[model samples]
Target: MTSPLFGQMMDVPLLASSLLSHAARHFGDTEIVSRRIEGDIHRYTWRDCEKRAKQLSQALIGLGVQPGERIGTLAWNGYRHLECYFGVTGMGAVCHTINPRLFPDQVAFIVNHADDEYVAFDMTFATLVDIIAPQCPNVKGWIALGDETCISTHLADMATPALSYETLIGRCDGDYPWPVLDERSASFLCYTSGTTGNPKGALYTHRSTVLHAFAASLPDAMGCSARDAILPVVPMFHVNAWGIPHAAPLVGAKLVLPGNCLDGKALYELMEAEGVTFSAGVPTVWLGLLNYMKQAGVRFNTLKRTVIGGSACPPAMLRSFEDEYGVEVIHAWGMTEMSPLGTLAKLTWRQQQLTPDEQRHLREKQGHVMFGVDMKVVGDDGQELPWDGTSFGDLHVRGPWVIDRYFRKDDSPLIDGWFPTGDVATIDADGFMHITDRSKDVIKSGGEWISSIDLENVMMSHPQVAEAACIACSHPKWTERPLVVVVLRPGATVTREELLAFYDGKVAKWWKPDDVVFADELPHTATGKLQKLRLRELYREHVLPTVDEKVV
Candidate 1:
């Protein structure tokens, strides 16, 4: 018998260009504010952005950029960078965002690996471009992300054949048409930071990007809307700035790009100037802003909600933002492999109906997965663990936007079609996933496992502690024990006994840190995550207090 079915539906492909077209047609007048690297505020509208992006498309075509050709951008979050995002993708070329924070050699490696034919960069990276350009011979030319005067007057002595971005676009007639490209075609490329090894590029499709934008714009995700002015302190090179560059336009929200200046004072000033209502960035950036505000006796004038990711957000940071600053902190977790947005900490209705303290506890966890993501924890036997909130295992996730394989690689990183997220986590009965530790960061004690994240969270909650990172230190009896390296608040002092006493009733006695060492500052990765590998190297030979015969 023939299956019963409804009438035929339209099969329009979801493309990234459609987003820009929608914004241009409906929200053309929406603002796109940027703090330029030249120490000035540059303002424009979505209409202007659309026009210039089209002009950029024409310029690239004039430069012999073919469809699917890789175009590299080593710039910060700004109007010009946004134009590159649309211009490159709209014309069916892949937009490869190279992280300038990566080592010069690493940057050259990524550029050469991607086989990028063209590069565009901010003036701040002119010297960096000069160093890496010689190594990246495949790069056809460099386009400075500024006007002719800014390039000549500022970067006059640069040896690269750098063209002015404005000049390149000005020569175009702004009449380029976006091609009818396949939805599954590659649109963007972002390389992993290579913390463990060499960086691997993750090529994303236009369809996946559009779907990610839709998921991020929903209320359960970023909750972006036209009424909100969004500031992305995260740079464009990192997972497309957590996909905010697309989400903002999808929802018609005002875009505020914080160019080269990510310092707390600069961020605060730009946020206030733009009347930013929402923002997304790492925990370290927010900590700096909070500290500056506390010292200056100032508060967020218009900023309301912030999504803290790139690493686990401390409970103290969350509480401070909600209690003292009247702003909400949403703890998000993701990786470059997942298009950088896997989970967000939005409370469910049942959880929200609970007491404020109960809700806060729920929020402290990573919360639940968004609409487009499927998550599960699996044991070593490759069996799925129960969501009882106790069985911690390797976290694996699969989604339309998730990366299945690295670019230029034949082997796949998927197991049973799900990408292993490299996170050890627990899923509660309500579907809330708590990241206990990274797969490599989890401390394996004598025979049991200890959660470094739990210990670090407790230590950070202490009033005197500013930042904390727990690493497994070698122990004679126990296979491994946690040694917490901490950075105390300015002018704050605390003894090791007092700090250990603070954790007395908080965690298990065996889970207690073996030692507490203080430092003036802690090392961090380019994306603001604590560099635990460096910490491990620094404290590899650190011996516990030695006693006569007991070795205590």
Candidate 2:
């Protein structure tokens, strides 16, 4: 037997710190603008950010932080949070980003589950930190991401004396060098939204993070470039802001971080003022911005494209951006376990030549797979489905960046080496994937499957409907029926009968919702995805009118 042959090549491992170093060396003058929680704008360059990140690492070392330990962050998308992203991971510590929007008990549960040694949070989370501090006994200390005045006034009464972010880093001269660890060393830890149960952690390594950054910055993915000003409306705590914190620096794109001011007006103003050419966020945030623009009769000056994910992007929202505002809406889909980037709806050159309407329909799909991810649809027997654009099945994916098993869990979540995405979807011959519905949210009525997403999209197209959520409700004849809960536009009037009638020609007769209920708002998860689990619980016993009539 012949021994395996190997080629001579450089063996340098890919690490997250190298990304910042590259940006600082080549794109040192590029700006990273952020809207501060202090009602002011903060500006810095990539070189400055690199220096401060090193200082932060040194400060953490001075405070006795060790490699392989978990350092938690409970802050929004801002400079300090950005520093923590690189510094903590660069020094071989796991950067655990906890979503502050979660319930207090959930937050405490995450901190305890991860065994975070120290928590660094923004001043805005002072009250929340104070409430959860007693519950998280393992946390050695708390660090406020603010100046001395912020700590003295906001966090003075904490159970433990809180350290100030500015003061802590000021003492260090940034002399510490980043450690060169194995490429598989853990770099980031993110927990799911826990809409079903307690949030589970997905641990990411240096190699995976670096590879994810490379794929995320591709021309077909987020399309990041140094010539563009990129704004990530997604919170930093959510899957590393969909990997933009890493991708932006990789491509030297000017970063504009909107810190907790997610309302339409503020976002529009920030984008305009900062010359943001590209942005990414959840559909809910874009809806607010679109509503504001429609009401104010305004238009964007510089924003050219936006990546909409965290939930299904309604067709109406996509039309509003492309047809009305001239902004391209790239519908995306992913989960925390996949490092949050699986596919982006970038049309191929062949598809782009199709008629405008044809192209629009193609763009509505979740999209083609990125280079690093390999996906397929499987049936109940775990057999692969055809790519005929009609056969829908469970979506499974495997990739270097994708999680093999969740943190601290003994069992692997993968079946046959592929992670089930919990999404029911179809793929066309061109390799474009369209998500029909979540497996849990798909409505089955009298043995017929009805896509709640399809029903909601139709209802959302109506002029009066502000938002809609379609869920399964009990039926006497049919096992289940679709019930749509709708929130109307302000000052708009539409009766339940009228709204239900509007769906007449849009869908099949049986596919139409059986009942329409007006609601002030719909429940959303911490990551901005619809909370269908909560809705299912809330209306599990709800009876359709036809069923009620039979009962009467």
Candidate 3:
């Protein structure tokens, strides 16, 4: 046969232009809405968003934000941050998203370390700025995002050239001519939550991030489309809200943003008013809505689906939404290294015939890999394990969007072609991947596996439990045991016996925590993750369970 390699090599542009361009081209008139603090609805379109992104690029350049220079944003998910995301990356500058949930000191550290020339933030973070601004020495410009009238004036001694959001964009010519960008050029940088150590930057290239957005938009993945109105409850700062904004628009989905108003009433109100069909967030955020539903009805007739990630999703939460509210929670798992999307729990057609209860059981697993993702589980000895689901081992994955290597650090997690996800997982015969725990977070009790997260999930299922954390405390007889630290709902309480009984027949009896302690509130990391390690340290000395307690 004639050499087909001579056929013209397919050439596709690497810039994020694909996502925005597709939306602006076909879905120009589709609505992209944002809910406001004063309970107002703001509506625009893809073309409007594209125009704003271009204008913002011109605005940044006008304000001395030259291409290739780093710009930072400590903001919420809304049209403004969306503009900054594409505009900054499109202009050939690196957009660094600072997790506002990060401690003020860590925020200052990241900004200064990235040598950010400018910072744009939503109105709600004015106080957060007050604490971190003094330390971000390289930030030369501060643009308070929103209408000029809404910006606060309690500025302290922080020295930075200030500009109003509207004024900045208005100063620029609406049309922006972007430079040709290489796929390898750094597009954006998102730091890990640094729960285990100092936060490190994961530099994303135009090629990697663009491909990830496309992968995320796939039907088996987020399954986003223009007809779908998505509310990404996850913060814009966290892995680009798990890449929802980037991918949702590309898939032609209407994005409804709840800016800085993530509480239950705020979220439910936005979801209700916007007619949101899909939403995504960590389990903690949704738990609030569940609580709110009990107090005031949760009418989510329009909301049929939501993606739950950034920690394990309680099976009970999944079953409750499916049973009560008629919503499906897609439990996903991934990390910063994988562009933060590894798996999604959507079932195949063959499994549809399964009973609802059986389906719920399967849906609790992490999920099968998306189209381009390849996965495996290996032992500590670096040997591959069978995907029998019952076999426990460390999980590994490799994909186009997976981290080739850390941005500046040397020790790589990749061996051969795979990147160790640092999560322990098991894959059943049907290919459903179940994450047992983060390799670092696993608890070895009497040489038996005791999933801290599973116990925590079961704990949070209790009506009186607003939130819960289960951590491994050192045990004399068993090298480790689960300690349940709980945050109770206001005006609700359950005795220890009552709470433990909630898990009866639900989980193996041995997996139950030896003791339970109630707390006014659980400690959270900057990214809103329960600080489980801290909880373990706090309760380390309390040896309430005797060796013979198992029999009792």
Candidate 4:
């Protein structure tokens, strides 16, 4: 007989309401801070926010926004957006967050697709709303999340009445009991970027979200606590800032909100001013900060550790922070399915004895799977590969919080009970998983897989390159070719030939980019992954020399 799930017998439903409110009841005085417009900072306590969120929930209900209604927010990370994280969901409704970074059409499509009844937006996104509101017919209303003094210069055409977020909250009655919520009911709907296809929604259950917060708080995961002041530089719309909003108050940690300004000088200023001890964001955000620090001659005095995800953290980026700046970048890997946290790259006790250089090398891998996560690499014949770190195969994973299926999509991706993460990986003798390449992003040039990530990481190590992205283009002989697009650092100069020369001795010449394209900036997805498919389309016509290129 199979063993029962440990908490299966428990009757109490773990809801986000319970998580946010419980902390407010006990840890009421804890601070949640945000840097607002014109560099002004605003602050609110957990108790204050919980009380307001409850009031807002009541106000929303009074607006005939019934239970199970879909409410959306188009604001950056702030006290108001954090309030709605609880307010909408706590009222027995679904909180839908739209990534402002998505194309206007995409933003409109998701809002209409989700049938969001209402939208609350920031003033800074007035132009974004003007473009999106008319396209989303189901969205009956738009409320601007700003003070009365802020002008809606770009929002004249929409019929929806734009009310200030403050006005709505001010109308709320501060005392309201959050209804007892069903654990399986949809609390939030997060859409996966349509890089592979159309963005689909993931309906997070009350139980899954609360439990995931607990799992994320563990030492091996984010290791978050009350002692830390956290700045979730990650967008709040993305998996609820990768679950930081819920996790931060779990221990009543002081929360710092960055409010959409992710530039290095701004983030460094916020971290220093807020005394932020920990933060999490995509690798690009940190990479910008690293470059900005080099030019500005600034330092991150308060930040001790960071969680790098959304893309692989280049070894150079990791070493620059850990070795030079005294900050640790814990590489975490996951997709929208696993509540998106499948792995955290932390060195084991034995590995600590390795020299710093060796540690940086090991840290480049995705690290071992976390406690609740079970992973195995399978060959073409369906046999599990040994953990020798050399043999590569398709990576298959299974876990509770991981998505078995995308909401409202039919042609099933799940084979049996296991979900194929669409990643190619290798398991080593030490039990660490080194991701060889993304299954889709993997280049099959002459029947051999070339990792675009590995190639990009190597090129990023070049001092003149600010960022690099590798994409596969069409090839006549090999059937596919790798072309690298590089973003040169400002004031630094390098030619395509120089970059190819840099790779001559390091990797097989054939593995080098068939041709390097220079871009002032690389195209990025809404979630920050390089939009390689676009690059592939942009450069498919130019063919690289095959026979003359050094294959050895």
Candidate 5:
């Protein structure tokens, strides 16, 4: 009898510091571009990023920030904020990214809940810091991401101890090495955009953050690499900007950050200036870009692929990108609970062999899950459903990067060891997932369910329609009927009956929205998801004419 010995390897921790160090050593010359809020472009290198990040780490340590303490950042996507990401996490403190788009109350609530010891912000959020400072008693100090003049001019007379980020880093030579940290230690914190009640925090560990970055960098996911120039239109406060801040540096991708200016013209000019090859954002942002380009008869000089998530991407938007701009739209789906990367709509070779229309249909679905993640659907009885492409159910997933529980909460959100995604979806035999609607947003008419997302997508496909949302309207006979609220593009016009007629042979007759209402704009959440609850409240008493009246 013989015994076998296992192979041994070095036991190095996968800390966030490793990503920055790898970039600094391997791709130091790569340029990191940023469109600053002060109406100018900021440029630096990864080598400089590492040195400044280390200096910021020294600054934090000098400010009495202890390991495991929460350090909050209220800034846009820029070099300084990026430095904070590595500096705080590398020094073993939790980097809490606060969403400035959130209400002042929610901002204060999140900071107090995380018990942040220090806060770093951009000039754009100087007013916000002043407003929330009185509410957050635990925040002891504030660091504005700028020089002395900028800080004094932009962020003046703060209640707490205040200073400029440049001044803080200037005092140190940046030679302080990063501390050795446990892989399982908390590294970052991001609060969900409270759809139900108060927002809940998702505390991420170094192990989870690194693993998520690795998974997202794969070719099947975000396809990040060193040669690509990435523009993250998505906010850093939103699920770590869908984990791009980590994935980009892990591969040394050039970063083009749009700071506080996301309008189509601003984004297009920045992308043109930086030669952004890849970008990520919600559908609304892409819509703005598409409209701006279409109006100007301009083409993307180098932008190639875009990852659309936070909400579903309409098929019209996909076609516009591919047909007009030659940009491949990667339809993605995720939530705050999943470290915000679950599935990306990448077509398989076999599916790509199909006709263009057929392939477009497949691309409309949220593609398969990336490696390290698994998903299944559950029926109303809490039983798992089949992957027949027709059996729609509640989508549930579990993965290495997924959250098991909310920060500081006692209850576990997992059911049978899987996190319920609150999305009603169907996983086909080929493994493509089509999300029909949110569990709460589905329209129930005469005991049959209808997908509001499907209706909205159909409506947005109209050339004149800029945005659309379908919600269940109160009805007398049918109990509930789908009503479409739409926003027409400027200089375009369409009648309600004309719009209704446009849906004639597309979807099921019953699934068609019974009525249409046009507005100047549709309300959206901070993350750019359609604010259906607010729409429902706005039109709670809306009633559809009887079917007999329609027959007349």
Candidate 6:
């Protein structure tokens, strides 16, 4: 038997606090700009953030917060919330970010489920905190993420008197040291949108978070660096702004937090003024920004690249940004379970050499996996499918950042150690993944599957269509057929027949929508995903128009 030899490398635990410490030491002067909820622009540096984070840790420790305790935050993206992110996690306590957009009942349920001791909320969410406070009995107290004036002005009428965030940190000196702990300890906790039942929590460890940050900053990923000014339009309450809050500090990029103001004009002006070189957000957000730019007849001065995730990016939106605005669009896909970053649609050298039209078509798919993630498509029989770009199946992924099980659940959600993504997709031989439809949303007609995403994307490409959703409606003969619900652009008009005919030659005749209905707007989840489940229920009993038997 051969003896195994160990390398003489030092043993060190990967910690989230070290990211902040490194930024503070190496890029102390790097700026962290924010549009505060207080209706003002706030600016600071990594050194200043580190000092305040230390003070916040001291204040949390003084409040009797112990290791592994959950410290909840119901705040927007800003300097104060960023401080809490590092401060709570750095002190060995779990930083639980509660999405304010969730229903009051869901918020309360998450608070109780996580057993959070203290919840620090922005003044913007003061009323929300007041509503949920009575339901979360285990929570010791609520801390307002504001100063004395803010609390007196905003939280004065609340049933529970909240402590001022500034006051708590003000009482402590900035001399606290972060404790060293096992890297596997939980550092952050985030709950799903809970569209069905009670929301479940995905607990993240220090090691996983740090590794995710490193991977996210890679050249082919978000490509964070000290020279870039990055704005995360995604809220801090959502997957820690898709890990920008950590990845930004890790690379010393000038962090720009867009506080409650997510409108097109606000985001566009902020990006122009800050000279943001890179940004990441969902497709719905970019839609607003593109509409604003087109209407305003303006152009970006320094904005270059954007990562569109949270949902699929429409081909039209990608073309508009890349062709018209000269901005590179990196279409990305991920879920909350995998630290929210799995694939990004950046063209490789070989793919880039193709014709521009071919490149555009290829860019529509979710790109190759990040270095840490391993994924495969499996058929109903649990057999792995080939990556031939035609064998659509359930997507399964396993990675260090991916969750093994829900936070307090006993049973595991993994199948053979791979977490099923609930998405129906095709992976090309080149390793690119294209999501055809969510498993629950796929339309089945006459024993054949129709991708609702494909129909919706094609409908959205129409000049007059503002937004579209495809749902499975019952058919008299085909069992279930595709029904499209469309929202038209303002002051634009298009007949249902014309829109339905527009799909000619674009997709298979059988895959074309059987009916089209106009809606003022489509439903979206709290995180901006299409609420197809709700749409399906609303259109479950919808009747399709009688058509020629041969045409059908």
Query: How far is each candidate from the true structure, as Cα RMSD in Å?
Result: 1.6, 1.7, 2.5, 2.6, 1.9, 1.2
- 2 versus 6: better lDDT goes to: 2
| Range of the 10 consecutive residues with the lowest summed lDDT in candidate 4 | 151-160
lDDT of 5 at 278: 98
Q: Any idea what lDDT model 4 has?
A: 0.84
Model 2, span 72-144: residue lDDT tens: 9999999889999999988888999999999999999999999999999988888898899999988999999
lDDT of 6 by residue, 1-552 (tens): 999998999888999999999999999999999999889899999999999999999999999999999999999889999999999999999999998888899999999999999999998887898899989989998999889997787777787778889999999988988789899999999999887899989999999999999999999888888889999998889898889989998999999988999999999999998989999998888899999999999999999899999888888888889889999999888888998899988788999999999998888888989999999999999999999999999999999999999999999999999999999999999999999988989988888899998888898899899889999988767878889999999998789999999999999999988899998988888898888888888887787884335435
Residue 534 in model 3: shift from native, Å? 1.3
Q: By summed lDDT, which 10 consecutive residues of candidate 3 come out lowest?
A: 152-161
- Residue range 1-552, candidate 5, lDDT tens digits: 688987699889989999999999999999999888777899999999999999989998999989999999998888889999999999999999988888899899999999999999887777788899999877888888899887667656655457778999999999978888899999999999986689999999999999999999999899999989999999998889999989988999998899989999999999998889999999989889888998888999899999999999999999999998899999999989888899998988898899999988988999999998999999999999999988999999999889999999999999999999999999999999999999999998888899999999989999889999999987766778899999998888689999999889998888888899988888888889999999999998776765444421
lDDT of 4 by residue, 1-552 (tens): 999778657577778899888879888888888877535788889999999899889878877898888999888999889889999999899999889888888888888888898898877787788878778877767878766655344345545568767777788778898788888888888888877656888778888788788888889789999899999999998878988999998878999999878899889988999899999989888888888888888888889999999988888898899878999888988877877788888888999999988887888988877777788888878788888887888998887677767777776677667788888999888878888888888999889888888899899999898899988877767877788889998888788899988887777766877778888788888888888778777776766765355444
In candidate 6 the C-alpha lDDT for residue 341 amounts to: 94
| Cα lDDT listed for each candidate | 0.91, 0.92, 0.82, 0.84, 0.90, 0.91
> Distance from true position, residue 309, model 5, in Å?
0.5
Mark the 10 consecutive residues where model 2 has the least summed lDDT: 543-552
Q: Which ranges of candidate 1 are over 4 A from the true structure?
A: 1-7, 546-552
Task: Provide backbone clash counts, one per model.
Answer: 0, 0, 2, 6, 0, 0
TM-score of each: 0.97, 0.98, 0.94, 0.94, 0.97, 0.98
lDDT by residue for model 1 (62-87), tens: 99999899999999999999999999
